[model samples]
Target chain A: MAKIRGSIVVDVERCKGCEVCMVTCPTGTIAMAKEVNHKGYFYAFPANPDLCIGCANCAMVCPDGVITVYKTKI
Target chain B: MTEATGIKEIIKPENLVYKRTKIMTDNVLSYCPGCGHGTAHRILAEIIEEEGIQSQTIGISPVGCSVLLYNFLDIDWQEAAHGRAPALATAIKRLLPDKFVFTYQGDGDLAAIGTAETIHACNRGENILIIFINNGIYGMTGGQMAPTTLVGMKSSTSPYGRDVKLMGNPLKMTEIVATLPGTYYVTRQSVHTAANVKKTKKAMRKAIQYQKLNKGTCFIEIVSNCPSNWKMTPVESNKWMEANMFPFYPLGDLKVPAEETTK
Candidate 1:
């Protein structure tokens, strides 16, 4: 069987932790960090990177354009 | 073997599927954490980049929450007085007929003070595009009641929800602008979700395409959210917008050319 491996990089400092990406993510790959950034806002990070599907939904819905998505086939 | 391939290799430029649009400047956006302005700006930038029209595009910034729009995009910009973006855009488009000119306006600017300019520009079928971001309440002024604010919607001015009897009704500016003979294409869209973002990007590209053809004015109303002014979390604001804003201002095209209306 083949699988599409996916990953995402979140610019922790630039993320506003709005959670739009979290709700919009179909695979629940994103989670908000408990610690806040210097801007005093929680930031989003990938909690289940393995679940990512390279959908890029998070980046599209991100208000800050701080997330980048990547994918490969295995 | 698969485990041997590190993430660095998978994330190389060739493997990268999505990244920030080059049209967006390095400046961090001035919008609130969850506000839709950033997404809308990104979508606009992506369209410009994809169409290779970054050099030919001119944007007019409205005096509102998005006044700093020029800072976000790497395009020539003119800051218009409150509600005068359409008028300014008209002049730019007329002078540079070969370029694609557009105005980014808020509901307060487009529907209230600039109502005449907006209406007249569309009426004249100005060879330009008007991008209207309607978030209902006045987000920049700490949540004042805007012309598009929904009835019974609470704002600083309308402490109690808007009273239609006293404050008049929420204006359907998109619908009003669509009826004008000058407008070639008009649509209402949002950027709350990924699908909506894609749809909005398509609409923006189409508007720009129409401008290249020297078609009449193109109007796009973006139903955005104001999390800070709405006194709700970013996610909550989107939910509230979907529940409340959509009913008063439904999404989809308000007008289109006869050629595109076929079976």
Candidate 2:
């Protein structure tokens, strides 16, 4: 079976809300979420999953060390 | 040979109790617990030793938390007035063009009052390396407001969030420094994690290389953690630096213009 490539899955719990990934993302898919976490910290979420090119921009830009990008092979 | 054990096993020619035979103990470091200054100092000492430039290396210690760096770094160091580390470095490098000179400054010292000196030095293409430590706040003066203080960050002066109306915006020194034509290499890195710590060392090494080779100005801004001032545990502050500050001051090389770097 051929692999299916898909979107970035961020662990919001681990996210420190730093927007490095947002700035580096070429596809402009990720956006800061309106909701605050238990720590009262706002985080970035995949706003346009469809627009995500699986470039690992979010992973590369994330300083919180919480983000991981799993590229689904199409 | 018999197997070595305990202190004997650790005690080797390379593992001498004292620092490099060449390093003078006149200068000592003055940083708080969990500060990244020690790590930076070790890296620099190693560079000076490896290059065998201790005799001619002139280190300029700036004002800020690490103001008393002249005490820690064993080389011949000069104390630069508040926010004038670059200027001091420029003067020494110009007078002794054959010598290796570098400046060590903190965010409060580099981004705040020393802005003009730093910009002018880089713009003039001074052949010096700047080891910039950005801990976000003015750590020396009791965690007061600093130009690099992030928004919503609390400090002695900014008890509330860093208001834009009053404090203005946080300065991204590396980004601004990279834009200068004289800058040969500019990188922004952090020492919050083990891997990043290694990267920071690599950047420092390269910055030193640029200076030793007389390429041009090399600016390495290290995004360090200030646990005492930030009022968080070492581990917590490291986490905070990674999550909140790393994004704003993204790590990686900013400028390495081939023309200048080739020289």
Q: Which tens-of-lDDT digit does each residue in B140-187 have in candidate 2?
A: 888897899998889988899799888899999889989998888998
CAPRI quality band, candidate 2: incorrect
Each prediction's TM-score versus the true structure: 0.98, 0.71
Backbone N/Cα/C clashes per model: 0, 9
Write down the RMSD of all candidates, one decimal each: 1.2, 13.4
TM-score of chain B of each: 0.97, 0.88
Which pairs of residues collide in candidate 2?
A3-A73, A5-A72, A63-B242, B27-B70, B27-B71, B27-B72, B28-B71, B28-B72, B29-B72
- Writing each residue's lDDT as its tens digit, candidate 2 over A1-74 gives 74333356566765556455665577788887999776565677878765655555445334333444544433
B44-118 per-residue lDDT for model 1 (tens digits): 999999999989999999989999999999999999999999899888888889999999999999999999999
Candidate 2 deviant stretches above 4 angstroms: A1-74, B1-29, B259-263
Least well predicted 10-residue stretch by lDDT in candidate 2 chain B = B1-10
lDDT of 2: 0.74
